[model samples]
Target chain A: MSAKPIPGTPVFTGAYAMRGYALNKMCYSLNAAANRAAFLADEDGYCAQYGLTPPQRAAIAARNVAQLIEAGGNVYYLAKFAGIFGLNVQDLGAQQTGVSVDEFKAKLKAHAIHNDAVKAGRLANV
Target chain B: MSNIIGSVATSHIPAIGNAIHKGLQKDEYWQPFFDGFPPARAWLHAAKPDVAVVVYNDHGLNFFLDKMPTFAVGAAPVYTSEDEGWGIPTVPPVRGAPELSWAIIEQAVADEFDVTTCQEMLVDHACTVPLQLMWPEGWEGIRIVPIAINTVQHPLPSAKRCLAFGQSIGRAIRAFAQTLNVVVISTGGLSHQLEGERAGFLNPEFDDLCLNALINKPELLTRYSAHEIVELAGSQGAEILNWIVGRGILGGAAREVVRNYHIPISNTAAALQVLEPA
Candidate 1:
């Protein structure tokens, strides 16, 4: 709980939990296959049923991760929403980072340099 | 008296479930991650645990913002995996050791942990993926007792508290009248963010510190607040709280039997470690 928050990594604290409760609850319903179909059948209706705020509904309609988070949507719950769109974490990462999916993927793949170095025995067991 | 055999900590990524469903254990992309398991499997098999005390955080599956429990213990006769929105095939129901589960619940509460006790809990990938990896033959042989920690919603249990809670669980296991062997498995994270502009953020250095600290100096990890953990390990990487509990359940000093760290497994820096008491 610092004045300067961890950049870009929004912690889903109690405030955010209370703020996003309705929105997250809708997403949580997506855990059941029937609920996923119900949402897809009528996205606006589902949002209304969940009593989502205008911003949360808008974020859901736009399929924007940043806007959703700004509207108090937790990433784990948002992931269920994202899954309805056939998007995985990599796709969400690409969308949020404003990069091509491949570029976002490359960024993740790039971290393997350390793995390579470690494998080469250049780094001791971590 | 019941025994604390060891602990296994691994990534419970949903992608791994899909890979398992597709028979991709040896696929080029998954080989490295899958390769990390055999040794752990060998050690775990040799340990012959009758019950596995799984410590993992539910990822919006069973518990939601409606009533999130910082720590929930499963006291059900069986724990089932349901659809997690990804359509990843659900693993078979995990047999539950209600007797052991209730014992841990009593002990954890006595130790002032105040954990939620669920008589019927639907476990998600956090429980299934790692359990599937450990018991690919199916969950018929060994029973399980799940402990779900809230790593999703913040005001998460601090590193120190989770480690302490885990030690209390260790005591519960040790005091049980059964002479059963037990293995504690904690799932998720090294470092890799899955949300926001820092979606692909990673910290191999922080992971290196943790992987070593789990074996050498877990108190070094307790010094951090949850926010500090998110800053160092990505938001999702805060799942290491699950790992700290796993380490603590080892009761004290333990020997690292095997360890593996790999990156980019669906926006995660996956790490697995199998340890036994020194």
Candidate 2:
């Protein structure tokens, strides 16, 4: 089956996998507390050790989700990068949506309330 | 011969594990979610399946992005949960049913599904969280066969493929000669995306639609492409593909004994349902 691309979304395929191999490996290393601490102590040296490309290193330094995705960093592993900075998944989401963290959180709160109301038959679909 | 006595479909959110670890079960934020699990606990006690075929995805634990397997089955003698960045509380090592795991692997290969067989694999929260929630006493006596799917990176197995894989698992378990009562536990997703600009997106409508279809018309879920799942449920919402595997094990029909859905569980909606063979 021919792949149908989602508009405005970077789908992580084998091609992306190949492209982000080094970048992802670095992110995967964050699974260990020691590795996370090491990366935090020396981000550039760690990125250099992973052999990340200039673009990938730049994206990592910038904490740009779009750039990371474009550079082949899967969000699951990118989460480790976000965690290193004490950022949660929602923070990454906020970055991706170009919204402030508080705004993104408010949006999440609103969505949950709307969903609860929908479940209770108090509101129509949102 | 062994038979699938029951099936469970639930979200394996890591925060759920954290909640249990921190004794937040009675906390106002988690009381309702915790309340929903008693029926599951009751069902587990009543069913008392000898083995649990847990279907979950590895969250950068056992397999990294370097060698992501589309489908991998654990054939080890014991499965342990390792440190996943954050230091999670220690849980007892889960006993593995190698005999059953190998049987499924053999059948899956013969059935043309190239499954990666793992003799040693460390499980992550995706596998452990559900086990903690469903079998809080620890999986000491009951054995488990862990089936890991690729939901982390894209090009994930389609919902149709996951169902087919589950069907293959059903056949393998049924074909085994041992008189074992088995439960198929499919963990992950009911709609909350965890990545991209779409993170924190929760679609209770889509979650309900998926749950209703799972009970009445499971095949309806197959029509949704992974992208469509992300569109409706958010990017991480694609984890619902794991639940499709459980539905596949139940074949076309099963009795839904308990169902619970909640939103905003750390940027994801959570759903849990217990199904018994009809």
Task: List TM-score per model, in order.
Answer: 0.97, 0.93
What tens-digit string does per-residue lDDT give for candidate 2 at A1-126?
A: 446655555667778899999998998888788999888899889889999999999998888988998898888788777777777777777888888988887787775654554334333221
Every candidate's DockQ is 0.62, 0.42
Winning candidate number (TM-score): 1
**Candidate 1 local lDDT, B1-278, one digit each (tens):** 89999999999999999999999999889999899899999998888999999999898777877788989999999998888886788878888999999999899999999999999999999889999899988779999999999888778889999999988999999999899999999998878788887889988878877887788578889999888899989998899999999888887888888878788799998888888888
As a TM-score, model 1 comes out at 0.97
Q: After superposition, how far is residue B176 of candidate 2 from its true place, in Å?
A: 1.4
Candidate 2 per-residue lDDT, tens place, B1-278, comes to 89888888888888788899899999987886778899888988888789999998998889997687999999999999887664555577999999999999999999899999999999889988989998887677799999998877777888889889888888999999798999988998877765555567677777877777777577888998877777777777788888888778767578788877666677777778888877
Task: Tell me how much of the true interface, by contacts, candidate 2 captures.
Answer: 0.40
Q: What CAPRI-style quality would you assign to candidate 2?
A: acceptable
